[model samples]
Target: MLAALALGVKDLVGSTGFSGEMLLGLIAAGYAGTDFIEGFMEKVPLPGAGAGAVAGPGSTGSGVAVLPDQSGNGAAAKVAAQMEANLASQLNAQTSQLQADIASLKSTAAAGSPETSWALLTGPSAASLTPDLVARLFVPATPRANIRTHLPNVLAGLRSCDLIDRDMLLMALATIRAETEGFVPIDEFVSPYNTDQVAFDKYEPGTSTAVKLGNIEPGDGARFKGRGFIQLTGRDNYTRIGSQIGVDLVGNPTLANDSILAGRILAQFLANNEDPIRIALADGNLKVARRLVNGGSHGFDRFKDAYDKGLRLIPEGVEI
Candidate 1:
């Protein structure tokens, strides 16, 4: 059936060239109509988004094939999402295999071991993220100061998760830097053990923000108020992120304060948000990026100011 479909598409497209893998993918994706397939092929065709991608390159504006989601759905969109997830699982499995293979290869190579070192495993970002860069990226006398000290470790966590591109790193920093107030506050705003209460100590379990963030019960408000650099708020978030990162964020909500763990969470969050965030970045729409991150235009001016300032600090030799 796939062979026949491929033949038909080929005949219909005439001069258009389609790869066997792509054709098989479209068939598997359950896409119908030659015209739809033709139009999709002409546009950015993302059959499977390639190996569980959280961060992607190219851009929708660039016509380099952005992963279509709610805005660009059909048989192709569904196919792409499924393909991405399946590919991601396959890639992780393949990553372990590749790591072992690289280990074997490194034994023969002059460098010794590539997989053992982050510089070898990570892309250009390994060199880009440094103390000096962090120093430059950080706003003068802001809260995100600790990020400079903790950057090397954060970069390592990013490398482990295979999210080490200039754009992605910058985007991550932009969003996180904005939310964490210069990376100053590792935990949420409200604290149960605080000796002195301030004006904005709003979280109290049944408050509006607290309820929206999934905080219930007596201490649930303070427990999952908002942790992590980007503020992973609410009980739902702690439980979900905990499961994703292999950390007991629910049981030990304080774990979100840990730099490396929090960094991982941040990377995951950025990775998962392809639409609007990555899509906006690809479109050169930084404002949209901020909007998507903030979930609205709230405090956008400050966020944009920080993002622009942060970009100046990225240094040369890297392209986001």
Candidate 2:
């Protein structure tokens, strides 16, 4: 045993490079026994020692390297936790900045987009008519109050009938300007051409005028007198137009005086004759266009004046 112990001491001293005093001490420990050698080894500091390692003999518990502890509450563990926290904070900050950047890009895109810019300029419907445009189209003597009161209904009528074309719109507007100078839907005056007793005798029941107008019933001429924006007249016209528009104009001809109904009646009438009117206007034949609507040149001058003014004022290819 003593021989083996001596050999182990020599090997330990040689491997550890212990000099003079340390080598002597190791030899003395080997002589003391295996237990003493083990105790001595436990007290000796090793390079790259792990955490929870016992302090070497004569160690000051400082300036010694240690591995990170697996257990909680150690210095190494605290440092690891602090590093993780810092990394998490930095990641969170970066994530927030990325989100903000994405939001700013979306906002910028929407603001600068062509569609959005056009929408802002043209409004929701891109309608051509405005109070300013209407005022400019009408003569100075035309009543502003009447235009304001009736223009909305007129626009609705034109739009409803799909009369958004520049020429069609001008023709309709001119018709209104000529038909009702005040832009009001009104009952016809007792003129010789309409309901005058002496002049309207030819329009009595069974007469040619009455037969032409389908005025088979007594008092039909007076009952179905000119009304609405276009002055819808005659029982035949009322029946046909009312059926086309799904209104009971034959039973209640007075409904035509309603501004909304009047506007619709006027637009529908124009739509019925749209083909010929468009052709005439295309050919610059205002007289034929006026005749198609009025059956004669009754309001040709006024219609021509209003149409010319509208062409000058309103831009071509304007949409509703």
Question: Would you estimate the TM-scores of all the predictions?
Answer: 0.51, 0.58
Query: How far does residue 196 in candidate 1 sit from its true spot (Å)?
Result: 15
lDDT of 1 at 33: 36
lDDT, candidate 2, 22-111, per-residue tens: 333334334445544444345443443433453543333234434455465586657435645765665566545544443433343345
Q: What is the lDDT of candidate 1?
A: 0.58
Off by over 4 Å in 2: 1-128, 196-202
Kindly give the stretch of ten consecutive residues in candidate 1 with the minimal lDDT sum: 108-117
After superposition, the stretches of candidate 1 with alpha carbons farther than 4 Å from their true spots are 1-128, 142-145, 182-185, 190-208, 310-320
Q: Could you give candidate 1's per-residue lDDT for residues 187-230 as a string of tens digits?
A: 65444432136422354454676565676666676677667777
Q: Which number leads on lDDT? A: 2
Give each prediction's root-mean-square deviation over alpha carbons.
26.4, 32.9
TM-score for model 1? 0.51
